[model samples]
Target: MRGKAVVVTGGTRGVGAGIAAAFVRAGAEVVVCARRPPEKPVEGAVFAPLDLRDPQAVRGFFEALARVDVLVNNAGGTPYRLLAQSEAERHARVLELNLTAPLTATLAAYDRLRRARGSVVMIGSVSGTRPSPGAAAYGAAKAGLENLARSMAVEWAPDIRVNTLVLGMVRTELSALHYGGEDGVEAVSRTVPAGRLADPVEVGEAAVFLASDAAAYISGASLLVHGGGERPAYLDAATVNKEE
Candidate 1:
């Protein structure tokens, strides 16, 4: 990845930061953008302030770029709010951040990406494929994101390759908050077939693969970095005795 330039949205921390670090390690000139700077700067990554929701700013950001080898749309998240707990506008906001923001960013970077024959990596979630009760809006947006990537891949073929990374639960700094506590995190981790939460660096490595020439022929693909996914709940609910 030497001499390659990569942009990672919301790359200040967490999964995004990991992705940026991985690219830096791979010798790419990585630039990380977010609305605010990270508390601790990501080593080897240049920081650029960007509000992905603002179309004008997104356009200018991309227009000023000399070249972009990869665009990783990794900025997106939602609070644990039930449908009834929030208004439609609140849900719409979530969708805008996760779905619309990527579209806006992509369109703005279209020319540069096309010129460089770049790749796009959409950070998706397993929630999109299953029932996400608390984060229904987020899941819906992610599902839409994957579909959008497929269409974009086809529309911009041979110039830009678009793909989705369907990720499972990751062990981020904020994991304890979502899983309750250490014990809760452990309990939830046990539910996954891998017996543990995925590391952010692992997701970063996968993103690197999708962006590198290693995946030259790959496009419009949904790569699962779910660590074997969750074990079927039905298996634990079975009433029949195993031993006769």
Candidate 2:
């Protein structure tokens, strides 16, 4: 990744921050953008201020960008709530952020990517593959996102590679808000087959691989970065009837 120019959207914090930091450590010139600024400067990354939800702003951002060799679309999250209780507007908002924003950004950056023969790594979620109970809309949006990546891969073939890193639970600074506390974190972690949440750095490493020459042959792939994913409930249900 040395000497490469990388752009990471929603790179102010959480998984996005980790991805940008990793690229910087690999000697890439990283440009990170978010609606708000990070609490502190990331050592080797330059910050770009923009809201990706606005199509015009997004288009302008990419047009004004220097040179990019990698683009990591990592800005997305769900506001956990049951679908029935949420308003249609709220659901649409989530979809716009999770799906539309990335699409707009990708299209805006297409030419530069083609010129550089660069890669685009989208930060997807495992919820898209399974039934997301509390966050139904988010799941639907992510499913669309994965499909969009596949289409983009074909449309931009031989010039750019597009892939997704479908993630599970990750331990970030925001973990406390989502998992409650240490005990809550442990309780949630236990549900995963790996018995732990993923480290953000590990996710960064995966992104690096997908963006590097090593994964040059890989395109339109949805790589599961979950900690073995959640265990099926039926396994334990069946165990209940077993003899001692």
Candidate 3:
């Protein structure tokens, strides 16, 4: 990745920061953009402040760039809100951030990416493939993101490669808050066959692989970084009849 330039959206913290660090370690000139600065600087990455939702800002951000070799669309999240609990407009905001924002970013970077023959790595979630009761809008958006990438991969073709990283439960600083506490985290981890939540660094490494020449022929692929996925609920519900 030497001499390559990479942009990681929302790269100031969590999974996005990890992805930026990985690219930096890989020798790419990494830049992390967010609405605000990171709590602490991410080693070897420059910070840029920009609102992805603003079309003008998005355009300016990419237009100011000299070169772009990889675009890691990692900026997106939604609070735990049931569909029935929120208005349609609120749900629409979630979709805008997760789906529309990335689309805007991609379109903004199209010229640079096409010129450099770069790749796009979309950070997706397993929630999109299954039921996501508390975050239905987020799930729907991610599902749309994957589909959009597929179409982009075909439309852009030999110029740019687009792919999605379908991630599962990942351990981050916010894990405790979402999982209740340490014990809750452990309990949740046990539900997965891997026995633990994935580290952010692991997700970063996967993103690097997808963007690198190692995956030259890979595009429109959804790489499952889910560590064997969830164990079937039915298996735990079954009762055994034992005769003494």
The collision pairs in model 1 are none
Model 2 residue pairs with clashes: none
Q: What is the lDDT of candidate 1?
A: 0.95
**lDDT score, candidate 2, position 210:** 96
Q: Rank the candidates by TM-score, best first.
A: 1, 3, 2
Q: Which 10 consecutive residues of model 3 have the lowest summed lDDT?
A: 235-244
lDDT of each: 0.95, 0.92, 0.95
Residues 1-244, model 3: lDDT tens digits: 8889999999999999889988998999999999999998899999999999999999999999999999999999999999899899999999999999999999999999999999999999998999999999999999999999999999999999999999999999999999999999999999889999999889999999999999999999999999899888887677766344
Q: By summed lDDT, which 10 consecutive residues of candidate 1 come out lowest? A: 235-244
What TM-score fits each model? 0.98, 0.97, 0.98
Global Cα RMSD, each model = 1.0, 1.3, 1.4
Estimate, for each residue in 48-128, the C-alpha lDDT of model 2 and write its tens digit: 999999999999999997787999999998889898897899999999999999999999999899999999999999999
**How much does candidate 3 score in TM-score?**
0.98
Summarize candidate 1's per-residue lDDT along 1-244 as a digit string, tens digits: 8889999999999999989999999999999999999998889999999999999999999999999989999999999989998899999999999999999999988998999999999999999999999999999999999999999999999999999999999998899999999999999999888999989899999999999999999999999999899888888788777565
Tell me the spans in candidate 1 whose CA falls farther than 4 Å from its real position. Answer: 241-244
